[model samples]
Target: MKTIISTKYIKNTVLAAAALFAVSATAQDADDTSSPFSLSGSIDTYFRTALTTSDADGTYAPEGASTSFANQTGFALGMANLIGTYEAGDTGVVVDLVFGPRGTEATFENDVLNGIINQAYAYWNVSDKTTLTVGRFNTFLGYEVIAPAANFNYSVSYLFSNGPFSHLGVKADFELSDDVSLMLGVMNPWDTNDISLTGEYSLGAQLGLYDQFFNFYYDSGRNGGLGFEVDYTGGFDLSDSFFLGINAAYNTNSETETGFYGAALYPQITASEDFAIGLRGEYFAYTADGFDDVPVIGLTLTGSYSKENLIIKPEIRLDSWGNDFEPFTDNDLAPSSSLATFAIAAIYSFD
Candidate 1:
């Protein structure tokens, strides 16, 4: 059978894939290190294969990578993440750098004259309730992050893949109470490290209560810019050995009326001291003005084993789409709505 993929999906894929990928505050900081002036980093490598897809002729555009990172075929290098932080009294600075396939993709926009940079910012704790930050930093938008060790599943989710990876702006973080917090900032658009070529600025805000966050981003609509995004992320511990994570986001551009939305659940069980298992079940969809909604469901199962600072993850993922969207070719070389993949990754961190 033959099927014509819609232009909307293509546009959405390109747009989402270009993101360095964004994140949230209540989430663990990918670059945070113990103590001050500590040099820490991680190295990751993986072996991935398409379970039920054939890519001999390279006809499938995304092949088996529908999300982000860990999509490269065969044995691949994820990236080298190096972070340096210095905190003295109330002031601190962080220089986070990355290099490799995953790093390149994460810093797609900042590769101009400065190679690859994951985040570079200076922060100061003001008073007991407020803090100020400036320079480029990872976005406070999604559950997943740029660092491999920070995620339960090596393969990123559609929600994280489509959001802004990092931002070049200034922000203020306020601790309202023992359990409440708020953060607000303005920046030169998404993924831009230098000046905003469009001369347009974007706004970001996050409100945290009892470890749950409500995030928002906004910009004027024109020439395919970001109009707004609303996101919610949180987690609950059902028991001592089991936890559930929830994330949902919606984004729309008023000018083009094009965007995406998604929700995902991460349920994990710590089976032993050095082993854990998790599942990421997600539903993601794209919306456009003149096209039917194209929705996809992704399920990823991952097993994690750790010894000291080294971790190994084995993952299996499957994705199926509706609205006649066949992004993969089956083993029989036929257009198919579903794709399966398997991968194992080795990650080591040092300080």
Candidate 2:
């Protein structure tokens, strides 16, 4: 798809942001009391292919799959991310930019270079326990993140695919106690990072709890009267080298009476400092008033190898449907009830 914004505008924005970032870094270096500004990010690329013979389009995944990072069977650029962070006293800011296929798809629904920015936000510490943040920021809903370096699996879950990616507005976070915290915010309508087409806003909140072995996060939000979504994420350390994580989400749109609900489980084992293996199992269903629910289950096995600043992830995924509600393409030139895919990605990150 064509970009909504012109190339000249994007170029101008990039130049302006670069100048601002340079100024901030220099000022921070000159100020004894200010925290240092940091530049860090990652670049990722991958080769993905469908293992099944049924895919005629060379894309084996189901329609509307969230992690459609490598739809075609070939090598693809995942993303190149550039993040700048600066903090001084009680004020801080984060500027994140990205390019490539995954970045464009995740942040702009496949619109090419509409704007290469992922997030630009600033925060102020109102008190020792409270902070107020404004501008565009990643959503608090999912356990997985947009950054490939942060995820155990290369592909994203259905739950993450359907939830909000970022919010444009203001929010306040509070540390309620040593193990509990809260966040509340008002954001532009769902999925519109730059503007609210509806001219309406959404309400967002999160409750979190954590200790040595367990962490939990719960969040819910609504876009005016349209609909609401809730998500929960939890993680527990099963052992020094083993961990378990869970995620569940539900969303409903009042106008269309359509929505989806799903959950996923992650189990990971770290064999050493440089190697780890993980599994993702998920079940998802789409629902409406009179229609029969279409359900799908997905399983993915992934292994990651780390060396210095580079990490390599190799993954295999299989998806199946209970009924004949087939949406996957197979080489058979007919709708298929299942699909299998394999991918390997390399992510290089530095600061």
Candidate 3:
């Protein structure tokens, strides 16, 4: 929380801007354009608690959490998301905005900009197989998204938490055939909301074959940067009610000799029209020259129920670092290798 950029003054400014955008999305477009403009978004909240006992003063109940978001104990608010789009002919503009704890973490610049804009971009269809996009957009390197309603599991994976969340750049997408596609771009570093003080840049690319994708990112800098990464993310439907999701990534900086590698599997089953269950199992590690590798494994079980626009998810998770590391404290407040926690979240979407 110490790193958060929000303050009382900044918060009020964001709220006012959101209200103005909402009104324009609903009322102003009618007189301005012949193309239909659209608006949509979602809201989420949750309550989480560690199943294990903590230190005497309870200073670190969820410090053992290996990923990001939904880590805070007790009741918490996720975020309020809003998206507005205007399309005409083969070109369009999109404005996505978010507010609250989750939004603050994702953009990392809403407070500085005096608004909650997460992505503001425009796209043009140059041909049947080629298109161009400019400005900020979510990262293309991961399976999970920042939107809570779009993901089956409420919490994200360590790979997702460590990898870039968004990019500020211009990208071109190409469709070579029915099953093959590609993307390439140059950007202002990974997860960067504003161009760096040094005016540095990065490279990004993705190759897609059917449902699978291979993503790559490269930055030349060594300090305070993500030097390089390659990722594979995809999923398959095995049966009418069974599905499998896969994600893996490796990151390393040759100049700095520091890196990490991780992989995760998701298996899910639909039990009924309103109920479904899923599990995520992941193995993650950190590595450096002249140092031993530190590895950890995590497993999560979640059940989801939905009716119309409302979805409810209940989850249980555990993380353990083997003999290589003892990152948690047990019931007796002594060093241990594992921790357990539980949470339930509610999400509502509107269009």
For lDDT, the strongest prediction is: 1
Where does model 2 exceed 4 Å of error?
Answer: 1-35, 54-56, 60-68, 109-113, 211-225
Enumerate residue pairs that collide in model 1: 20-165, 21-164, 21-165, 22-164, 22-165, 23-140, 23-141, 23-142
Find the 10 residues in a row with the least total lDDT in model 1: 2-11
lDDT for predicted candidate 1 compared with the true structure: 0.76
Over 130-246, each residue of candidate 3 has an lDDT whose tens digit, in order, gives 888888877777777777777778988888887877777888888888878888888886676666565778898888887678889997543655499999887777877888888
TM-score against native, each model: 0.87, 0.85, 0.86
lDDT of each: 0.76, 0.71, 0.74
Candidate 2 Cα lDDT to native: 0.71
TM-score winner between candidates 1 and 2: 1
lDDT of 1 by residue, 1-351 (tens): 111111111211111112222111122356763444556778999988888898763222463336777776788899987777666889878778888889888888455645577778887878778888888777788887777776778888989988888888888888788888888889876666667778788898888888788889997523556588999887777777887888999988878788899899988888888888899999999899899988999999999888887889999988889999987889898989998889999998775
Q: List the pairs of residues colliding in candidate 3.
A: none
Per-residue lDDT tens digits for candidate 2, residues 256-306, read 778889988888888888888889999998888788887889999999888
Residue pairs clashing in model 2 are 54-330, 54-331, 55-330, 55-331
In candidate 1, residue 203 scores what lDDT?
A: 92
Model 1 CA deviation exceeding 4 Å by range: 1-36, 57-65, 112-114, 221-226
